[model samples]
Target: MKFTYKIDEKTELKMLDLQESEQLFYLTIGSKETLREWLPFIDFTQKVTDTQNFIQSTMKQYSENNGFQAGIWYEGKMAGVIGFHKIDWNNKSTSIGYWLSNDYVGLGLMTKSVKAFIDYAIKDINLNRVEIRAAIGNKKSRAIPERLGFTEEGCVREAEWLYDHYVDHVVYGMLAKDWLNKNKIKRV
Candidate 1:
């Protein structure tokens, strides 16, 4: 597996490591309020150990060949994370989930990172389908897939329990033939 993905000169994604727990935890705390609204795992992550546990789980996921979680680094700082929930090899499909630090909202970082992921999924892994689901209220999050030309498939009612309330999600999908990043280089 690739250790790092250079999104650009200023943006990069690294496979999450155990040593990054502190930095990851701090980044999570810094954006907890904003993240917690849409992500159910935020409230459960209260300390560095919690972040470490998450990393361990991702490590297991990697070892099992299910998928991976990558830390988003911007200009040498932890900015966020993007990852696959799992790969359904039988169907050649996978679902992606991501979160960005509140500080780095409008830099077009997420849109770029997501595009790279789609390219990797479709071109590198030869996955036939990619899906991204975002809370209906989160316009910014939902925009990534749309900006990348993903088709808005449908909505699932109360798809996720965010702390105390269930939020609806809009599902966006792209097929390998529909992905337009034909010129991207796939890491071997």
Candidate 2:
């Protein structure tokens, strides 16, 4: 699968690579406190090597047609990461996950990036269903799916283990047919 996706002039999504691990590592470290509240694995990513390993693993998954992770770039800076956790080819479905730097919040960059990815998943990749799971209190994260017209399927109680506790997750789902019927989303 192709690794780069240009959402617009201001934003783009490119597959994670080992060469960028240092940058990603610093970005993660800088956002550790903010990201730790909802993301369980942040604490484990203490060094650049961890980020490099992650990029290597993601590349392996991409080669295997399992899934892929991409770095979200906004105005030439690496602002976040977004990707499918797994693509169930047999079922024609996939689950998406994303995290943006605190500085980039409220810019609608993720919403636009996700919309473009969903469109690519359904139209180009031929995936029929896409799912997004966000922690119950993460209104900003949940809003992306909502803004793009995903249905709230249900809640998974204590679905994710945060640093010190667990948090419930709200599941959102969208089908290819529904996506195609929705109003066209303009690229950001």
Candidate 3:
């Protein structure tokens, strides 16, 4: 489970040095100012340093489990985060999630990033499928998959609680073949 690779900046937006989509920004690490900007969008009250430490620690875990966790760069700084979690190499599946700094909302960077990541995962990593789940009512979060052509699998009622509230979850997924077919059409 050695997850080590130099992701090309052009091929992987997560690795890009300049991340901007009109009004949004992206970065891997944030400065003190960035911390203040993103603090509210963050679901936890932990210090910025704590978040950084958690990123480092989780990266190690992802490496151990043979997966990837990439920082979503927005504007000229770190505006949000996204990653592939719980990779099952044997089954060639992974779960994806993301959060945006409040300032970067309404832009379509997540959709772009998700599509790019999916392409990377399926073609580069040779994964068979990728899944995305969001707690119901999070329309902004859930739209990423729908806009990218993922099929709605179903709903999981009260599957997990977030911010002290039990939330329903929606699952979306895409297979490698479907992804390839869609890309082929786009190239036509």
Task: Tell me the whole-model lDDT of each prediction, alpha carbons only.
Answer: 0.90, 0.90, 0.64
Give the alpha carbon lDDT tens digit for every residue of 27-96 in model 3. Answer: 3233324343323333443344544555565667664865656655544344556678777989999988
**The candidate that achieves the highest TM-score relative to the unseen native structure:** 2
| TM per prediction | 0.94, 0.95, 0.74
lDDT ranking, high to low: 2, 1, 3
lDDT of 1 by residue, 1-188 (tens): 65578989999989999999999999999999988888889889998999999999999998988889999899999899999999999999999999999999899989988888888888787898999999999998998998888899999999988878889999999988667454444434
Model 2: weakest 10-residue lDDT segment is: 179-188
lDDT of 2 by residue, 1-188 (tens): 45898988999999998889998999888888999888888989998999999999999999999889999999989999999999999999999999999888889889988987898888888899999999999988898999989999999999988867889999999998888878554322
- Among these predictions, the greatest lDDT belongs to 2
TM-score of candidate 1 versus the correct structure, residues matched by position: 0.94
Where model 3 places Cα greater than 4 Å from the true spot, the runs are 1-12, 15-43, 185-188
